[model samples]
Target: MNPFNKSTGRVVLGGAGWSRQIVTDPTSKPVLQTILHALSLGIRAFDTSPYYDPSEILLGAAFSDPALTSKYPRSDLLLLTKCGRITANDFDYSPAAIRASVRRSLDRFSTTYLDVVFTHDVEFVSREEALGAVKTLFEMRDEGYIKHVGISGYPPAVLADIAVEIRQKLGKPVDVVQTYCHMNIQNTTLQRSLGRFYGDAGVGIVLNASPICMGLLRKGGVPIGELGDFHPAPRGLREAAAKAADWVEGQGENMASLALRYAVGTFASVDEKGLGVTILGGGSIEEITENVETVKKMLKMEDNSVEALDLRDYSLFDEEAYKKDEPLFKGVRDILGEWIDYTWDSPDAAFLEEREKRKNQEK
Candidate 1:
């Protein structure tokens, strides 16, 4: 299940943030340059999806570039793409559809085999459909079309449970599992549940995305990013995020810098070599550079120092639940208490809500 060797570091370059830009921009030259720059910074893994507009095509063109291909061959890079969820309200998990999706991704990515392929946002579909798509992906892996198979979604519990379900049914474990918004400073759900994933489901690698929690943990903090239109968080949580930013600023530290370092430090290998992987999205060259520099600072910090331990352990959450101390961290945690483990309603929830509305109208 663990395809990567000990030498492979964990920083993955994500293509979602650049999804819009790549599609609207007339030239691929800028994005290509950013990709090349990221590669130079030791980011070997790239994560993209068909749902993210033209991300797959942009990455495909970047890799297909003669200059880039010559510098970093396709074999050296780990290319990961997702399927199933098409739009906010659209998702298709049938085996036939999945097979076709893989074909399209393969064609678009210009690769015969994908290093990893995840069933996107499994939380939105029926459990049967999600597992069915995963089983199909397993078949694809067996057929030599995919090197690894897994699922991606919002709920950490659901992802871990499905991984266990796959093992029970198939007699084998998922090669990798990715869950976002769980490992960041605001939420520590992943740390508590990772043991189940590693021991019960036998997941090889645990991939954490949206380290900044999709811009919720950014400099501006609350009122999150404009991307909230697609997956809007609760109003209370947004206000708490804003408060946390103010608190962080009052402490003479930048919210984003602290957040980035905390995440990278927590997941990163303590030794010189990076042990764990974290997928980071950057729209520009400066953003990518800043992320790399943050890790460098984390790497150089003395292991026993208070700052290092604080960043690594974070102490925001315990095994049982998230802690309510450290003033700033506690203040934000308290505001999010009601929705601590809460995720926004999925498409399935929306369907049920609509059904209820119709029944009420009939009555």
Candidate 2:
């Protein structure tokens, strides 16, 4: 049986957005409230990372709170996090660094073991280093510090190829693989690679993150505040996204909502058992509520269903509403045109060269 088949695991609550809040305040009440509200709505899986600075701390506090622990025990929740990528321009895949990072995450989360611990953004490091990190994680798994080992990165093809290599060298398949931006509206490359992940690599779970392309597909354009400047999309993609957002708004629709629904619907429809899980992040309770509602609508759950009724108190989602938005979704895709499936180089060429230079110096 698929371990993630439970409703709670279908949509994972991502912790990166929480890290954005950490920039202004050490602990954010709004983030905590949003998390508590998500729990009340039956969200059980959470994805975080040490690199997402204090995300693990904030989530740890909430998870340890009496109000939360009383109702939801540690065993009932799925805690997923990552290691290796330490900062924006820094990455350490050394076995010692990987082990230290995992221990730190465990300390921050106040938990004995993480449900999943990925070698965050493996593409940034050398292939030998990436495999070494995964092997180190496997060792921790055997030692009972981690339940599963995985990898998360931007390039689906690179990630898929690594998964295959891990299986061949390590003698066992990775437990999970996560790729962001590739499964969203503008790019469906992750969908094309799903067969490779499942059939060739024997991956157990494939997670799709950044359904809205890290806010690029939204109406206001890529957010320009604290967490906005870090977006790596080039001018061409950004301009195309703006046009798509404009067209979507002209039709009296929200670009982000439509994109979210499209992504969830597409992934859920990949196969009978579902080919992927979506990792989503929201800065507020309203946004989180809307995200969960979109998931309910995409899965075609009944209006009177428990999860739906909890989130549907304010907005109603039904087949008629979903069908009405299809054309607008198509229009946005049409506007995207040439930018469709376009992938920008992550850790761009300059950074890769600089990183290699630094590694050589260390040697």
With candidate 1 superimposed using the best TM-score fit, by how many Å does residue 279's alpha carbon deviate from the native? 1.0
Residue-level lDDT of model 1, residues 1-363, one tens digit each, is 865552245577788766652234423437788888887776778899888767778777888788898888778888899999887667899999899999998987778999999999887777799889998999999999999997888778888888898899878888888888877677767776677788889888888898777777766643322244444577777776677777777877777766766666566532122345678877568888888766555454333355532222222212121111245445545655665555565445676777578669999
RMSD of 2: 3.1
Query: Model 2, range 314-353, lDDT digits (tens) per residue?
Result: 2222446557668877788888889899998977988988
- Residue pairs with clashing backbones, model 1: 10-277
Against the true structure, candidate 2 has what lDDT?
0.81
Task: For each candidate, give its TM-score against the true structure.
Answer: 0.82, 0.91
Best model number under lDDT = 2
RMSD of each: 6.3, 3.1
Deviation (Å) of 131 in candidate 1:
2.0
What is the lDDT for 320 in model 1?
Answer: 23
**How good is model 1 by TM-score?**
0.82
